[model samples]
Target: MSTNLNQRLFNAADSLRSKMDASEYKNYLLGLVFYKYLSDQLLQTVVEQAGELLKEYNSLEKQEKLYRDFLEDESTKADLIQTLKDVINYDIEPDYLFHHLAKQAKQGTFQLNDLHKGFIYLTTNFEQFEGLFDDIDLTSRKLGQDDQQRNITITEVIKQLDEIDVLSHDGDVVGDAYEYLISEFASSAGKKAGEFYTPKMVSKMMARIVTLGEEDRKIFSVYDAAMGSGSLMLNVKDYIKDTRNIKYHGQELNTTTYNLARMNLILHGVDNENMNLNNGDTLNKDWPTDEPYLFDSVLMNPPYSAKWSSDDSFMEDSRFMRYGRLAPKSKADFAFLLHGFYHLKDTGTMAIVLPHGILFRGGAEGAIRQKLLEDGSIYAVIGMPSNLFFGTSIPTTVVILKKNRTDRDVLFIDASNDFEKERNQNKLTEKHLDKIIEAYTDRDFKDKYSYLASFDEIKENDFNLNIPRYVDTFEEEEPVDMAQVGAEIKEIREEQKQLQKELYDTISELTYSKEDEDWIKGALEVFKYED
Candidate 1:
């Protein structure tokens, strides 16, 4: 069933591929999908609750009675909507439901103003629905230069999505299909894709690392400073031993992607009560909170080398104060790292994906690196292959951090060679992921693959934690056999000489005109095989 929806949704999305950029069309598709889900949820809720009240009547008549009774009294209608608001956090009238709109569209009776009114109703009353539909502008000429064409195009898209049954109880098909669409959009979105989606494979490995050996405690909290469509936070839940209850806290800068993240959590069945996803700058003005060092695990894949305000004022900030110097203004890599680190619990684990420059850069970044290493907060660094990301081909590294860590040795993993090359990007297969994770878990010292560098050894290199410096992945050239190669060359020359002599003899016996035979013999003589 999931496979069917995945194919259908992707095909539906392609209908608008030529009209607009994928990054733009993605919002329209995802927003409408969310609307359909919420509408179906409301329909199912009303039917179940109303059916119980009319259980005394027969089946067909009971259905009619349920609808009539709910609508007959204005007070009952208000009470029911209030009850729905309490349960689902929002209310959707039957007339404004997706089915109602989709049916009208199919019958050629749908009005663009009708769709506009439904969106207005939701956005006006629910803060969560704000700006989510801004990208799907009915008045945008991109949909069509004329209002009629725009209506037809949008109507067809809605009718297509209305075929999928999002109300089924068969697993999390809705979330899985949404992920498929997001992945497709990311593939075509180029550099902008990284801002909204981290490849699932990378997120899964980081999730496993953070939740590796933890027991099923009563409460577990996960944070991604740059949440990116909530893929990373949702993925961490998959690796936990017991996820009866988990809290997701994240801040994202982009508004459209932020809305996508919220929708993703809701469709994955995460209640609004359990999540605190924010749409704001994580670095400039972090969501204010009194609880620092409260998260059990922190994960981040912020834009590499993004610029930030580097005033000396940040020196007083709790996240950057301990690092001695702020991360360079031009490169906020360490700033994001430190922010997540500060919010981490003493027993928490943190993993971040950053460019390789953070390992050996000089000046301000270097000083911060030295201080972190000396504090023994650095746990392990795994070097990954180049071109693993969507847009960039530069190799990246995953640096894991642990607070109050007992070990003073830094584990260096050279997994840069362990990847399968796809068309445009390198990918970590399950086998590759397993090998890297095993090495990380055991802290094994495999020759040329991993090394445990003592704190003193790292200090000797001025606190440089480059993979090649600690774990030499370079292989020595095999000793060459000069005599063997010389003998083979000699044998080949002798064989060529014999073959040339045979050709000369054969040509001497051939019939030809006198001038042609002379030219043939001359040509044969010039083909001498030098020994």
Candidate 2:
């Protein structure tokens, strides 16, 4: 059912693929899908709560008609709206419900203004959903050149979506389907995908590392300073025993992506009270300065090699002051790392994805790497294959950090060659991910694949964390047999001579003139035996 759901949702929105860019079209598709989910969920919740009141027409097939009938009663209408507000913290009018709108669309009576008003009502009255639909511009010419054309386009989408019964599925089917759509959009968005998506395989690996031993904890807190779509932090939820107790904290620099993260978390069943998401620059400003600033697990996949202000005033900030030097303006890789690390609890684990340059690049980044090694905060460096991400093809590494670690060695796993190539991108299959997780958790040496480098070994190389320096993945070429090679060459030469003689005899018989015969013999002479 979920498989078909994913396909239906994608196909429904794919009708507009030729009309606009994926990056732009995603806003409309995801926004409308979320609206349908909310409306359907609300209707189901109300039906369940007002069981006796709705018992007469409670059949699933008649749900929309029954809802309309129930809301028509003036006495029950106000009560229903009030009850919904008290229960779900918001209410949508019967006329604006997804079922009503979809019905109108099917009957060719849907208006773009009606949907716009619905969105405005939710964004204005619902604090949780405020600004959520800001990216979905109903008035944009991209939808169509004229309002009627736009209505026709949107109405067609609504009719297609009406085929899926969101209320039919149980237990995260809606959320899982939503995630599938996001991933599909990311694939279509190409380089723009970096703004709001992280490849699921990489997110899974980081989640496993950070939640290694703390699965049984009563309460676990996670943070991603440069959280993109909040998928990285949500992956941690899958590993925890009680996902409800896992508090999510994230800050995204992109406003659209910030809203995307919020919708993603909520769609995945995260409670509003459990999320601490903010839209702002993580590097220039420090957040979560209030109580419980630190987290038990800090995971990040910030934009690689991005520019930052690197202002002198930040030197006095607590997050950067300890490092003694700022991450350069051209590359804020270490800047994001330090921010996440500063918010990591002493007993917590931090995992971050960065470019390979952070391993050995000199200047401020080098100095910071040396200090981290000296303090034993660096735990493991796992090099990943190139083209694993959506946009970039450069090989990247995941550096795991921990506070107050007893181990003085860094585990280096050369997973650069571990991925399976798919189309234009390299993918880390489940088998490959499992292998990396095993190496990271066990911290044991595997020849040519992973190496446990001691503090002294690192010092010998001037604190360079390059994977090749530690894990020797070079396989010796197979030894060549010179005697066999020479014999084969002789055999090839004899065969060539036989063919040449055969060709010379055949050409001699076909020759009609002395000049032709000489030319043919000369051409054949070039293929004669040579030492």
Candidate 3:
């Protein structure tokens, strides 16, 4: 069933790619898909209530006449819209309905202007309401260079998506389709993928490690500093059952991705008010700057090695001020680390993926590491396999920080070799993730795999957080047997002697026979005497 749905969805997406670029194509197609999802859900609720009303009215003597009258009544239509608004948790006017648009599209009269107006009408009507089509950009470049192209592209995309039942019991089907498109675009977006989309396995590991051994009903708030499409933040919802109790918050720098994040949150059925998507740089200007805000669970896969202004002005910034030095203008890994650390609540746990350089870089980074370790907030550092990301092959580490750690020692798991190699990419399977989580939860110090480094020990190493320095993953060679070695040496000597004899025989035969050996010796002697 998933295969069939995927094929149909892919075909629909492929049909519109010619009119737009792959990256832009995603936004356009996904916006229409989300619109269809909202419309379908709203229509389903209305139809169900309509059916109930018709059943009740059918008990009268003029049952058929009453049903016809109710269907045609304007007040009944208004009530249906009201019920739809209330039940679906969003306002969907009749004109914005997917079936209505599909009908117009099939009749060849649904022009781009009409579709754009419908989308605008949808958002404007619901602007005062709770859940609205806040992310769909009618003027987005993804639609086309101009109105004509954009309309054609959107109309066809909507027509194709309108064929599927996106509001079925398997309602996540629409989200799954959207995720497939996200993964496709992420591959082509290169480093930009890190901004919004985290590898699924990495998100799983973060969510699993943070929620280890705890009941799904445990109330907690999950946040991400760079919540690209809000995938990482939303993945936590799947890991936990009582997600309604958990509030989702995130800040994205890219306007497009910020919009995507909000759309993704709503499409996944997250209450719009519960999920806060902010646009702007998280390090410099925090959008949702509610003082001392902290989360119970934080997971982030920020851009690897991004550059930022570590100028003197930012020295006074609270996120970096406490460190006493700025991260180098060339590398912002530590900057993100400090930000995540600051937002960590006293009872919160945060997991972040960073380049290995953060572990051993000298100067300002070193001082920050020293402070983090000294404060006992650094919980565990697990080394992940290489090529786990979309654009780069560099191995990354997941540093788990906790404000309320039971142990003073930090857990280090050398999971560098724990991955499945498929094609050209390395993936963390369920087993690999489970093992890392087990070691982290149990705080096990397995030989050659994990170690518990104390604060003093880390300080003794001058605060170098390198994994190899703490957990010696090197394996020693086995000792050789002396007696067997000596016997093998003797056998080699005898074999050399026989090989020399055979060589001498072959050379002597090629030059002169044994009978000419004496003659050659006598000639050598005579020549020496003459000299």
What's the CA error at residue 17 for candidate 1, in Å? 2.2
| TM-score for each candidate, following the candidate numbering | 0.83, 0.88, 0.79
Clashing pairs in 2: none
As for candidate 1, its clashing pairs are none
**lDDT per residue as tens, model 3, 401-505:** 987566657889999998898665678898987888778877878888899888788888888889999888777888989999999999997787676666555
Q: Weakest 10 consecutive residues, lDDT, candidate 2? A: 170-179
Badly placed stretches (over 4 Å) of model 2 are 1-15, 50-61, 74-83, 86-88, 164-188, 487-531
Q: Comparing candidate 2 with candidate 3, which one achieves the higher TM-score?
A: 2
> Cα RMSD (Å) between model 2 and the true structure?
3.7
| TM accuracy, model 2 | 0.88
Give lDDT tens digits, candidate 2, residues 1-531: 676677777777766787887777766776787788788777776776677454664543466665666689897888888887777667787788887898899899999899889999998998888899999888888778999988988988888777666656643443355456545665656654544566778989999999999999999999998887788888998899998789999999888778878877877777778889999999878998997899999999889899999999999999999889999999999999999999999999999999999999999999999999999999999999997877677888999999998877999999999888876678899999999999987898999899999999999999999899999998999999999999999999889888878776676567467667778778667655543
Ranking by lDDT: 2, 1, 3
Give candidates' CA RMSD values in order. 4.9, 3.7, 8.9
Best-fitting candidate, measured by TM-score? 2
Steric clash count of candidate 3: 1
